[model samples]
Target: MGGRRRHARPASADDLLSQLGRLTARVREEIEVQRARVELAEALQRGMLPSTLPTAPGLRVAARYAPARSGLDIGGDWYDGFRLSDGTLAFSVGDVQGHDVEAAAYMGQVRIVLRAVAAMGAADPGEILRTTNDLLVATDNPLFATCLFLRFDPRTWTVRTSRAGHTGAVWARADGMCGVIEHAEEEIGLPLAVMAGEAYPVTEYRFTQPGALALLTDGVVEGPRFPLEEGLAAVARVLRDGVAEEPETLADRVMEVAECTGHSDDAAVLVLSHDGPEACQTAGAAPGIV
Candidate 1:
């Protein structure tokens, strides 16, 4: 038995204060690290994206990107447009399979690969996706991406599109009619990098009059507790109602759904509008520029 009962002294105020200071400092350090990561990821993604969309006479292009409100706000979603050697405009929207910095890095790699492949004369949208897929698979990085690539010929007002595990686009006509560019389930191909060789079928649609075509990543429409079909319908409605608006204005209106739904993923939209040959003539546009 103990000869005397032992009593533990309470921690002094100074000791408690010191511990609190250390804990606070640790937390602040962690917060700074997280902030740094977010900044770096954002910079990487922005740098990879096109600073200016390629412009043509009869066609107007505009794009918008919104990072996820939750978590790091770093995502693999990207949109790009450039003028091909043939003077046609190529626009692409893609989403890589993650929300971290690694996903952002992978996104840059995929984008660069696609642009390079397109520049190398992969004229067909399907061929562009296929070659880009092959190069991505060669990396063996175990990440996949879904892409929608469209080539718009301003002269003929024809749009050729290919999809890789991505959602269909929405199109609105000058007559105020709008519809989603849904593909047959069997016709759609797997996302890039799931296999070494895959086929992405192409779909073609023509714009006989002035209208708008919208391509977006899944995050713009799908989210937890939000049905994808509903989102598509909502986007179609926006396009139907706002078809005559400026591309940038229409893009902002389309993005409202993503903001309202409170999606946890990043959202991106690229809108291409054609103003008809008459408008081009009135604007004194050059040939092949459209």
Candidate 2:
């Protein structure tokens, strides 16, 4: 029997318990590190967005951005509004292709490039988007993004918009009629970075009445359990029925409805309200309308 000297029962049960405790501690430490990384990613993504919406006389601007629910994957949905060097009020909403840190980083790069291009006096939204696409392609950025870019002339209540495979924007007239801006087959250009020289056409919409234009990411319309049409119809209904009196209020109310109905993706909405003739008289240079 002494020959076997049975292997000391694989350490005592207490020793095994101690080893298990160490393993558990290691796992907890790793989990904490992961949590910290996620928090940092979220903060960086938020920093990519506008700290404050730019002020444009005669135009009331409001925007909302909601990330996916806690513990869910992060996303790259962004909204931006600013006054260009030439006094053109530019607004944009975009969604990058993925729900990860890479997508978020790409979004930041795209947004920065777009802003830079706009600042360089790229008057046409279509041209701005085209240049952005070219830049992305040149950089070998593999990610694609859908974006709606609008250039608004507060003086004339005129809007020039370009779409790059993005959701159509909804316009609510002063008379309460809400409808989507129709884009011809050719007008809906390919998403950015899809082709080296993709061309986006500019579509013009004049606000004849004191209404608002709503620019949003697909996440706002495509709910978990509904088709795209259904989601768009829901949004149209919300606009038609009158959700809130102010642009910000309306944005909040619409997002609340979407969330209540199980919208799981990230959602962003930017509402720009035209004050009609009464408000257009505010001081501003008559910038070149696209």
Among all candidates shown, the one with the greatest lDDT: 1
lDDT of each: 0.85, 0.80
The total of clashing pairs for model 1 equals: 0
Considering summed lDDT, which 10 consecutive residues are worst modelled in model 2?
A: 281-290
Pairs clashing within candidate 1: none
State the lDDT of candidate 1 residue by residue for 1-290, as single tens digits. Answer: 86997899899999999999999999999999998998899888988899999878877889999987786668899999999999888999999998889999999999889999999998999999999998899989988999999998777566788999998998787787777886788768899998878999888766656778889988888887568888888888888788788899989988988975669999899988777665443454332121
User: Which runs in model 2 stand beyond 4 Å of their true positions?
Assistant: 1-20, 70-72, 278-290
* Candidate with the greatest TM-score versus the true structure: 1
Flag clash pairs in model 2.
Answer: none
**Deviation in Å, model 2, residue 35 alpha carbon:** 1.9
RMSD of each predicted structure:
4.4, 4.3
Give the deviation of candidate 2 from the true structure as CA RMSD. Answer: 4.3
